[model samples]
Target: MLTHLWRWTLFSYRAIWQIDIRARDPLHAARRAWDIQRDPDSPATVFDIIDEFGTTFRVDLAEDNPHLDAQPILATPPMPAWMARLLPRRFRRHRIRSRP
Candidate 1:
């Protein structure tokens, strides 16, 4: 029981962290979320991940995305759309200025 309780606590903390990381950097968070998806403790379903990407990145194509119903999706900045191919990923994430 004690071990299970401890594991649940850890999972809660990790879930919060995963949400935070996804906010700051979706790519890295995807990697981390993938890792969590493979782990036994993850409560996230495939639907949860799909929702996360669609909602967080505003890539909602489905007419029934749950997050889309709750709030309007935020538009992505124009520059970052092609910036990864032009600039390295790390630099592109930080460089929010208009193209030079």
Candidate 2:
């Protein structure tokens, strides 16, 4: 119980920190990490940002997007544990059968 509480506390702290950073300048951070850009001339309906590690993130800020709420920003094909382990810790949690 104590160990689980500790892990949850650490995760919450990290998440809150990220939220604070994003609150300051979300678009800049997004662009720096994933190369996503919002153009005044022609803003992309779906922002695609690819990280240096080749991870693609799709961002949909439009409220009309049908799957906007439910869709995972970085959905992955169902993969086995061994394959999923190769992914980042943040992504591994979304894996079909990922184990911490």
User: Against the true structure, what is each candidate's TM-score?
Assistant: 0.23, 0.22
RMSD of each: 17.0, 13.0
Candidate 1: residue 80 Cα off by (Å): 5.1
For model 2, the superposed segments whose C-alpha errors exceed 4 Å read 1-43, 64-100
- Model 2 lDDT on a 0 to 1 scale: 0.45
Q: For residues 1-100, what per-residue lDDT tens digits would candidate 1 score against the true structure?
A: 7767864562111111234345457777788877876777665432321132222222323335445344424433435355566876777756554432
Tens digit of lDDT per residue, candidate 2, span 14-96?
A: 11111222534867776543432334533334545433333445555554653523433454433657887788889877554
What local distance difference test score does each model get?
0.45, 0.45
Clashing pairs in 2: none
Task: Give the runs in model 1 whose Cα sits over 4 Å from its true position.
Answer: 1-35, 39-41, 45-68, 80-93, 96-100
Clashes of each: 0, 0
